[model samples]
Every structure is written in C-alpha cells, then in structure tokens.
Target: MAQQPRYAQTPTTGGAPAALAPSASSSAATTSTKIGDRAFDKIEKTSAEFFAITYGALVRQMFIDHNERADIVNTQLDQMGERIGVRLIEEYAARSGAPPCRSPAQAADSVAKIGLKMFNPQRPSQWLQPPRSSGPVSSSTGAAIGDAANGSNGGAVYSISFDENPLNVFVELPDALRQTLWYSNVLCGVIRGGLQQVGFVTLVWYVRDVLRGDDVNEIRIQFQGKERETFKVDMQK
Candidate 1:
C-alpha cells in the first residue's frame, strides 16, 4: 500500500484559533492583488500559441537528446528551470517591487497571486483559484496556511492547484510516457529555485497532474528551513 503524506498543523497565536486577522488579511490581499495587476500590465507580452509551440519543441528535442529517457529528461528540465528561476527572480523583484515574504504562507500566496499573474499570459481572472493551504480554516480568513505536520520542526506545507496549465496547452502524452514523464515538472523546479533565492528552503513535487488523468493539476510545497549563511559563502567559492 502507498503511504500517505504528512501535512503541517494549523498555525495559531496566543491560544487563539489558527487564522489571519480579518482586516489585516484583507488589506494584504488587496495590496498584493493590485501589485500583481500592475506588474502584469507592465510586462512584455508574447503570443500564447508561439510560446506553447516553442516549449513543445524544446521538450521534444530534450527527449531525443536523452535517447527518449523520460527520467533523464525530467531532471534536465528541472535543472534548466532552476537556472531560469534564479534569473527570473531578479526580474520579478525589479518589476513587481513586491515586499519580501516573511513566512511560508506568505510566499505561497505571493506566488499564486503575484508571480503567476506576472508571468502567465492568462488574465488574472482566468486562474482557477489561488493556492490552497491544507488544514482547518477560520471563517474570517478563509483557508490560510496552517502549521506543519510536525509543528515542532517549524515548517509548513501547502498546495497550488490549476484547472488549466499554459504549458500543457498543446500537449498530449503518449501511453508509453504517461507513467514516467512529468510533462510539466519544470514548474516544480522553478518554484523551488525561486524560493531558494529568497532564503526559503523547500521541497516541491507534483501531487496530481492533469496529464496523468487527474481532474486538476496540483503541486505540493513543503517548507524545510531557511538557507544557512554558509550556503551563500559556499556558492561563491
């Protein structure tokens, strides 16, 4: 039998229920939404069909380059995404002028509300929904980030589900590759790399894939810990 995954606990303050303060939460959401909208309007636009076709070509070439080894192609895609993400963060910071995230919850929210809007060609309203945090919700705040399954470890976990994925726009997987290839795995690496640039260490993976016959595409994100100071020094060496 497959083992179930553990999740984070709900966060709380001073014995109160785990939830964001109503007014504060609303204000923050509004501000972030506006920032996202502005950033999206300012960024350069591209033809969706062209982008999709180009990406498809890249993936197909990768398969051929790797002798049709899906696993190797997946890893290379992630690595490529990481490099892109590292550079993309610089553009994101400059263009969005958004504030830095203080918690895993905040990061998840920003990615859904801001990052996706800025980069994705789709209109903000078209996004199926914002990222969903696991665990209980407060009536006022709706569903917000909760504590980690191991609260003692001081981490959190959340998920982002999409009804539509732009990359999968013109993609159809063959039966032979369906079970082995994660068609959109680069996204997982992009998120992981982007967060790492901001000091958060995270573990990201696909929980559900639309290509795999899932109703909605979902990616799970687990906060591990902050990057150590030494990490920067080591990278410079």
Candidate 2:
C-alpha cells in the first residue's frame, strides 16, 4: 500500500470538528444542503475493511478466472498494454520525445511517467530505484525479473496505490482535490482504458478502499492476465 500525498488536507478548526455554522450565503436553502458531515460519513462507511477485502478478493478471483486459458490470457494482457502503449506512443510523440522501450521494466517506467503526467499534474510520481521488475509485471517467460540467490522475484506487476492514506473525501475539501472517490477514479479508468487499448485485454480493474469505508483513500490494480516483455525503462532515481 502506498502512502497518500501531502497535498490532501482536511479543513480543521484547532484539530476539532467545528460546530456547524451557517454559511455566509444569504440563501436559506443554500446553507440547508451544506451536509459536510454527511458526505464524510458516507465516505468513511465506504472504505471499511469489508469493502477492501471483498474488492481485493474479487479482483484476484477475476484474474485467476481469466488465467484459466493461460496462453490466451498472456497474449490478451500484453496486447491490451500494447494497445494502450500504441496510443500512448502517439501521444508521447506529440507531447515529448519517444524513448526506445526495450524491456518490461522500461515499459512500466514509461507508462508510469507518461500516464501520471498526462493524467495528474499536481503530485507526479517518482519511479523507485533498482529498476527491478518483479511480481508479474508480465507473464512472459523471457522477461527480466530480478531474483535473489535462493529465491525467485515475483513477475513484473505494477502495484499502484494512493500517495496519501485515508483521504478525507467527505470533509471540507481544500480545492486541491474534490471530496469524492468517484471523481478520483476517473484517472484510474483512463489508465485502465489506456492499458486495455494497448492490448492488456484480460486485466481485472477496480478501485479499492484505502480508508476503511471511505473508498476515498485508495485505488488499486492487479493484472489478471499477463504482459509483454518488451522494454527496459530507467526508473528515475
């Protein structure tokens, strides 16, 4: 699980829930629908453990089911990623120079950087070092996966989590971000869509609860199928 970013801050009055005060707005009904607490409570209730475990398990199950046809699953996932990569390549070409993607690691790093930048501009992601591809990033046999002297590294898989923990979606938002996971997941869908467009057609995509019942806290992805061992990207140190 990734930690949430620093930018997400909830409004506070001396670290306490301030009493509901009438908004300065002169409209009577305007202040009446100012249900700040209600939204937060709903978000809190949504991110509960039940939602996380159930959602996580459902995604995992979907992957296994897709994997029933190992050969097709493998091709399907890579094609999906590739399809996204193709469209992304054109986008990248239009926006920036296109670097040669020669391995799975490279592809992951490229996707992460370009995807994040084209999607979110506020807090961009920094790729971790060691440039190791682990945990099913792709199911390709020839993919480069780092391994220990006595153990095996998981295949190359991209594990994405929010930068902040328990983002308060229902609380008074700071305008940096709105108070809704539903709004945030649009980024996720764009990413998922890009991947599918690139040809990782068999992936299981869904949002996960990071803050118990809040759903505002986290979004997650697990490749239900496979990816192509095509590129080696430099994870920005």
Candidate 3:
C-alpha cells in the first residue's frame, strides 16, 4: 500500500472555525444578504484533509507529467491559477457588488476584505502596507524576481498574510524538493489573472510560505499597469 501523505499535526490557527466580524452599521443586516455571503453559504464544506489530498494529487500528477521539473510545474500552476482568477473576478464582482478598484491600495483592500474574508481565515489586519516606490522594477519570470521588489506602474506592491494554509494541511515536502516546488504559487497566477479581467496588469508571487517556515505565510503582489492588446494592420510598403 502507498504511504499516506503526512500532515503537519501541530494545532494551528485558521480553518473553518473562524468567524467573520459583521459590519457595525445598521445596513449590516442588509449587507448580510449580499451575494457573496449567499455564495459562500452554498459552498460545500469539506475537511482540510480531503482538500489537501485532492490538491496534492493534482500537483503530483503535474510533477509526474513534467518529470518532476519544478520550474515547469510552477509555471503550469500559475497558468492554472490565472485561468481560475479570470473567472473568479467575474463571479466576485457580480456576487459582492464591489465597485471597480481605482488604485492598488483599493484593490488590495477589496482582495483582503471581501476575497479572503469570505473564503479564508485572513482578515484586513493581515494586509501589509503597500510597498513604496524607489527604483526600477523587476520582471516576473526572470532575474527581476530576485531584483528590486517594486512594481511596474508607479511601483506599488501589496500583500496579504495567511496564518494557516489549507493546501498545506497534509503536506510534507522532501528536503531536496522544497525549493523546487512552490506549492501555492497558483495563488499568484490567480491574482494576476483575476485582476487582468478588471483592467489591471500585475505581477504576483509568494514572498513567503509556511511550508518553507516563514513567520506568517505571505504573498507579495505588484501592480504593473493595464493590459493592452496589439493588432496587425496591412499597409502599403
């Protein structure tokens, strides 16, 4: 029989037991009836163990398909996330009734306030201040990922922290493959793809991961600019 995947057994904060603090305004009652809440309610609740196993299997398959190549796996994971994000944004916008974000800070706030709150245990307190602009920014898939942490459009960076990562519930990474596998990199792609639908171009990636043993799990995101399409036209030579 295959050895069952090992889970980090330590009791940690986060997961489904956490409650969302309702707004204090009188309209709070009305807000409670909003689409996001309704949608969240309709979601099928499942054990983290199950989610972990299922997600793990998917990742394992990808690794196998790619001959356990980490870089390719990471890229594939991000693409998958971006596709999900593209769809998720439409769903979120329609359900939450959130207005279009005007700036990076506003976008980050909505991502934390509505996006994370409804789905995960993260709260607004977990959001870090947007990174300040100083120098040239780095590219996403190149040496820039290791260079200045600034973004493209006016160099604004935003981030959120997660105390408990459901995906990591039953994960035990082999020492040799730890750096090779970015277990949650899909989130970076998701954020990038989701915001792209709303007219924002961004570069998102994990600055930290609990599996890698960082203080609090963090994802650092940068706002690049608006995505544009180019077309070819026939002209007299």
Using TM-score, give the best candidate's number: 1
Best lDDT goes to which candidate? 1
Better of 1 and 2 by TM-score: 1
Lowest lDDT block of 10, candidate 1: 1-10
Q: Rate the local accuracy (lDDT) of all candidates.
A: 0.65, 0.35, 0.62
What digit string (tens of lDDT, one per residue) describes model 1 on residues 1-237?
211111223233465332111112234246777777777777876655556666777888888778888889889888887777777787677778787787787887777777776876432222222224343322233244443243324457666666667777657776677778887788888888888888888877776677777766776677889774211212221
Candidate 3 structure quality by residue, lDDT tens digits, 142-193: 2211132455455567666666776776687766566667887887888888
Between 1 and 3, whose TM-score is larger?
1
Once fitted onto the true fold, the runs of candidate 2 whose alpha carbons sit more than 4 angstroms away are 1-89, 100-103, 124-155, 164-183, 202-219, 223-237
C-alpha-based local distance difference test score of model 2:
0.35
Q: Per-residue CA lDDT of candidate 2, range 92-145, in tens?
A: 434434344443444444444444433232122222222242222211222222
lDDT of 3: 0.62
Best-first order by lDDT = 1, 3, 2
TM-scores, all models, native as reference? 0.73, 0.35, 0.70
List the pairs of residues colliding in candidate 3.
none
